[model samples]
Target: MAGRGEMPMRPARPGPPMQYRGPPPMARARVEPIDREKTCPLLLRVFTKVGGHHQNEEFAVRGKEPKDEVQIYTWKDATLRELTDLVKEVALAARKRNARLSFAFVYPDKHGRFVVKEVGSTFSYGHGRGDDAKSLAELGFQIGDYLSVAIY
Candidate 1:
C-alpha cells in the first residue's frame, strides 16, 4: 500500500502441467494359436541357395552343411507364404516366375557362432502380403533353427 511505487504480486508457480512421459507401451506377446491337429510337426532344417545368403562363414563348419538340403516337416504355424510354398515344392530354382525367396535364421550364437539371422522376404508367385504373413512362431523361430533360403 505504498503511495508511490506499487510492486508486490508474486505467487503462482505450483505443480501440475509438464507432461511428456514417453516410453512405456510395448507389451505385445500374445501368440497362442497352434493346434494343427494337436500339433507335433517341427523339423524345418532347410538350406537352399542360388544367388545369395549362405555365409555366416558357411555356418562355420559342424558337418559341412550347405549342399542344398531341404527337409521340412513344418508347423510352427509355418508361413513365409507357407515357407514359400514349401520352397516351391523342392526348389526347382524356387519355381521361377520371377523367384525371390530370401529368408534366414541359422542360429547358434553365445560363442557357438553360426548366426545367419535374416528373417523375412517372399515372392514366388505374388499376392502373399508382407513378409508373407511371417510365422514360425512369428520369426523368433528357435528349434534348432536353420532355414537359410535365398533364391533370387
Candidate 2:
C-alpha cells in the first residue's frame, strides 16, 4: 500500500497473442452431371379406352375390366411427331382398339394454366420440313413433365 499522494503499481497480466482466423474455412460440394444412359428408361403415360370404357393405362381400373397396360418409352430429345410415333409403337392397339387416342402436348401457359394443344397435322406442334421442327428440349420440357393423352 502507498501513503497519500503516492501511487500504487500493479503487475500486468499476460495473455496469448490474438490470432486471426480469416473467413471460416470454406468447403465445396462435388457436383456431377446427370447420366441419361444406363438408367431406367423414361416412360410417358397415355390414356386410352378398352371395351367402350374410358381407362387410364397408368392407373389400374376396378370391377373386373382388363387393366390397360402402361406404355414405356426411352428418354430422348425428340420432336412431337417422334413422341407420337413412339406412343403408337408401344400401344399396339392404338390403331384398332376401341379407344381413339387424340395426342396432345400439354404445357402451362404464361398464366400458369395448363393448355392442351392438338398435334395432328405435320404443321402442328411446330414440326415441318427443314428447321421448323421443334425438339422437346427447345420446348423447355424437363424430366417428370406430364403430357396429357386424350382418348375418346
lDDT of each: 0.84, 0.48
What lDDT would candidate 2 get against the real structure? Answer: 0.48
- C-alpha-based local distance difference test score of model 1: 0.84
Best by TM-score: 2
Q: Count the backbone clashes (under 3 Å) in each candidate.
A: 0, 0
Summarize candidate 1's per-residue lDDT along 21-135 as a digit string, tens digits. Answer: 9999977555688888888998888998889889888878878988888888978777899889888998798899888888999988899988898888888988565599878
Question: By summed lDDT, which 10 consecutive residues of candidate 1 come out lowest?
Answer: 1-10
Candidate 1 residue 25 Cα shift, in angstroms, is 30
Cα lDDT tens digits, model 2, 1-152, are: 88899989776768877789889775542233335676566765444342333333332323332345345465535555665455556555544434354544444557665455554322223335322344555555556444554444
After superposition, candidate 1 runs with Cα above 4 Å error: 1-50, 58-97, 106-108, 117-121, 129-131, 135-137, 141-151
